[model samples]
Target: MMSDVFLRIENLRKEFGATPVVNGLDLDIKQGEFVSLLGASGCGKTTTLQMIAGFEKPTSGRIWLNGKDITDVPPSKREIGIVFQNYALFPHMTVEENILFGLVLRKVDKAAQRKRLSELLDLVHLVGLEARYPRELSGGQQQRVAIARALAIKPNVLLLDEPFSNLDARLRADMQNEVKRLQIETGITTILVTHDQAEAMALSDRLAIMHKGVALQVDTPQATYDHPASRYVGNFLGNINILQADLRDVGSHVSFSANGKSLQVLNDQRLSPERCCISIRPERVRIQPQPTDCEVLLGATVTSKNYNGNSWDIGTETELGSVNINIPHHGAPTPDRGQSIVVGWNLNDMRLVHVD
Candidate 1:
């Protein structure tokens, strides 16, 4: 069964003069779902967010929020909350006062406002620091204040625009977990825009990969990573090994041949033999002392090795090409540079994709 959509963007197109920023983009966000618009800079992720927030009007398209058209609605009347990258908290206002500003503008009573303020403070875990101003708070604390203020309005939809870009690596991880927890607790329909692939994958229920003003692919994070729609998405998500090979249709499988070496791979789908590429993740490749107990094995010499705490990122030169692998540092003896070894992988790990 499909989830009920709370927000829909239909044929959304935004242009500044002649250059199109968002081109015919369509997205349906289910209620209580967390979706992230992910891409590099100038990919139209920010433009899409701004159009949804009513900060920038779309050149041609329609936006529906909870069954009502809001394409031309003013930002103040949209009932949507936004947390900017800068945390955008009022400099002069205290934490509590900043959170209460929206409520006060709507003429909410003082007693009710105080009660909500207490709840928000507890929700964001900033109870004792309510009296402190934004200038006095740390970066993480200021972000929490922004979240509290956004949630205080009880918005129908929440938008986060690179909300963690300002924090350091450690704080960014902490805030990612915090944001995921809060989204589950509140069940607010949230859309986040960010260029960080790991951060988007960590927090989003579904991720839309944008490129050159178009959404290239949209799916679960693992699905997009494992089965990318195009070469660009495959390269963007993580480290992958690409092979230029000539594919031949053998009885029940396909044979990928390159540099006088042939690798037998199972045929999962019909693929064009003329122009195709094989992609495999580094972690899927196994290294052994010699050629033993493997379907496809290649003799290689270790070129480089980098220890990353628990795993070793190894680079090897083989008959096919230079391939990289990530392996457990403790299980096997660490292969040193200038050492000979055999590399093998299961046929299912290799994917036949179009040549980009």
Candidate 2:
């Protein structure tokens, strides 16, 4: 019988000498879901991918593919497709040869190989570049060949490890869109490993945010960005200002007081009387000439400003600490350096986090 889950990673663990790279990692990928494993270097994202690919044997845990245990399977016998960051295309071989190399090795029928090669060339939008060598093609084209080569085997699961990292910025964006379109068209269950939060947000149906060999949050991009479970995730995903606050005794609603300013709390479950960390995203902050009554207000001095076409990043040095605010470029109030301004946010905009 066909399984409901396409891939299931249970208690996956990996260690390198004294350091544990993947510590008890568990993930469930449904069929056709595009999941991205996002983390910084040495955070075990690549190691986890390697383990799943059977390139690295896990120190422990079982990996199930289509409900069959494949933790002990060798890379060659795993029947999975993988595209690396470096393209890994043979410089001596032409695009057609490189793509056909896999099928050739497997001794696929000559006619079948020719058909698959033609289909892949068309799928990757390189229908007539069969004769062009890897050196002759652009970086984006080479990457496309690499992807096409991986998909030639028609593997059940596709793994991409920083696939567009080598491309230029513009090319990288184009490749991201192309990969998303290809994945949707092919309905491949793909797992992409990337440190780029924007890339993960753009491509993934759900993203697994890793930190120091642990999965911090695995959810939709919007949910992970808006409702980070910890300070680490909150800081890693985007620009967030964390403030130290003390919960104040309020009658019905809980309030947090920080640097002589009080902010009401909408949710009481996560709030505590002890000191806590309040996380506010840069976009949630509002800069004003004067403090408002219902808003959590703090006096801040403008430190720096950056204009990035669509948005302006305004840095402010407040009594609590330095904080960054992102304002839309169209009608944003310009705050001069050394000028005092009021930074305010609503209670619902703030997230109370445990001080860790």
Q: What does the lDDT read for residue 278 in candidate 1? A: 76
lDDT (10s digit) by residue, model 2, range 221-252: 99989887777888889968887555664654
Which 10 consecutive residues of model 1 have the lowest summed lDDT? 266-275
- Alpha-carbon local distance difference test for all models: 0.88, 0.87
Alpha carbon lDDT at 172, candidate 2: 96
Over 11-43, each residue of candidate 1 has an lDDT whose tens digit, in order, gives 999999999999999888899999999999999
lDDT (Cα, 0-100) at 319 in candidate 1 = 70
**TM-score, one value per model:** 0.93, 0.93
lDDT score of model 1? Answer: 0.88
What lDDT is reached at residue 161 by model 2?
98
